[model samples]
Target: SRLQIVCWTVLVISAYLVILFIRFLNAATITDPFNITIDWHLWALLGLSASSAVGAPVIASAKAAKEPAPLQQITADGPRIDTSRYPAPVTKAAAAFSRTEAEVAATGSGVLYGKAAPADARFTDIFQGDELNNAMYVDVHKTQMFLFTVIAIVGYGALILNMFLTTTNPASLGLPAVSDGLVAILAVSQATFLAGTGVTNTPT
Candidate 1:
């Protein structure tokens, strides 16, 4: 969700810069170079993205605070337990190996604390589940949000480019108007993404 907001922001800023450049090139003197008209739909799209970006983390954090501590098991060698509630391992073998080490380190000390640091992050993490049990699975909400964001960026970019190419007045060229439908689609996608973050399949 944050990435999507950054993409839209970059697109809008780039377009705005290009418009300003065109205005400078066409005129010798301008009173207000930064006075570019922005359509309300564009603002609405930005607001939606910003709201989702902010709300997702708040929702996830709240959910995490309410989750129960992870369950563990004791063994002859050491403590053996699932680490899914902690940071995820990069691979199944790594997870197994970590568990073995934990078992070996167990000295019948009933106290256990600390969490594993997350492995090197990957772009694929965006589409994967947040909870450890389903971390390897694809998240439909994230996938849909990603798809819609890409579509909006591409569609809006093309519209702006087409407008620039066909406009008779470069000095008057403002940001291209976004359609209500595209904004609506993005709004829905962001809402679902936030909703998905608030939900977890972890057994209570």
Candidate 2:
């Protein structure tokens, strides 16, 4: 969400700068060369992204706090956690004691309670689930969010370019207005992303 906000910000500012440059070159024909404005809807779109970025971590952390840490065993294929060992409705004290005993008995072994370092990070990680059980699976929420962000950026860029070409005075034109429908699409996309973070299939 933060990344999307930054991309939109840079796109708008860059487009504005290009217009300013054009106005500078054609100073004789234009009045108020630096008079550029950003639409309120654009600001709202950015605000939604910023809100999602801040809210996602908070939701995840809240969910994590209520769950007990699962003991993970480093297998030949990958790290695997035995969910059966820490059954549901177990008390916090019992869970803690069980975790300690498992840690001691498996000290020399590969069993542990932490994430293993990835051999290498990839951009595909963005579309993959963060949980152990579903890490290999593609995250539908993340993929949709990424696709929408790319589409929004590309579409807005083309809109700005067309405006610059068609307008008699590029400097006189305000920033392109974002439609209410596009803003709503982004809002729903971000809301779903946050919702997915809060509701996890795996135990923490």
Candidate 3:
């Protein structure tokens, strides 16, 4: 889960920084007490961070793909099937909404969808029916995440460009140092995404 991954990342980074701090304290590096040591070996941290950046979204998409079919919640005994409410078809429009029992039984013109006919002679032929049947489909959390990811990539690129053009450190532009900013951005982004679940009542 994202929460577990986030917590573990925080703990690992915190422990690494604490170890560095202790080493700084013990090594008589106090002449510039505020200064910290970070070698290029920290590139390993960057590499892991980059891997997770790519892996997280792929994991989320695979999980979404593996979600149980929506119809699994329905059962034969759950709802009484009433053909009365399902009026006979008026005219053949589309394969999904075209089959009438009379036409099907007499002329053998019916279409079988996944071994079962769709109710009401509507959506009688297509497997899973229309993908856009739900108005909220386009507004799902995944779409929002994807859009924000693109925005973040563009925004970060712009920031890097500005820093290069200005010949000034991030601190001069009221930004946190790179590592701290990365941590803060990831934490906030994760929390924002999680908060949307509460607001939207979306299942994890």
Pairs in clash, predicted candidate 3:
96-123, 96-124
Candidate 3 residue 118 Cα shift, in angstroms, is 28
Error of 2 at 185 (Å): 0.9
Model 1 vs. true fold: TM: 0.75
Q: Candidate 2, residue 157: CA error in Å?
A: 1.1
lDDT of 3 by residue, 74-177 (tens): 33779743424432222221233355534433432122112234344432221122111211123344344444444544454465456447743222222212
Estimate, for each residue in 1-204, the C-alpha lDDT of model 2 and write its tens digit. 667878987998888888788888888877778877788999899898888888876765664445433444444888564546643222222353344443433321111122224555577877876543344568888889989999989999899988988898555676899999999999999988888766665544
Clashes of 2: 0
Residue 107 lDDT, candidate 2, scale 0-100:
27
- CA lDDT of each prediction against the hidden true structure: 0.71, 0.68, 0.37
Error of 2 at 114 (Å): 8.5
Residues 1-204, model 1: lDDT tens digits = 889989999999999999999887777665667778899999999999999889987776664554332355345888665555452222222253354434422311111111344464678878977653455578899999999999889988999989888998765789988888888888889888888877765443
Judged by whole-model lDDT over C-alpha atoms, candidate 2 comes out at 0.68
Instruction: Report how far residue 193 has shifted in candidate 1, in Å.
Output: 1.0
Ordered list by TM-score, greatest first: 1, 2, 3
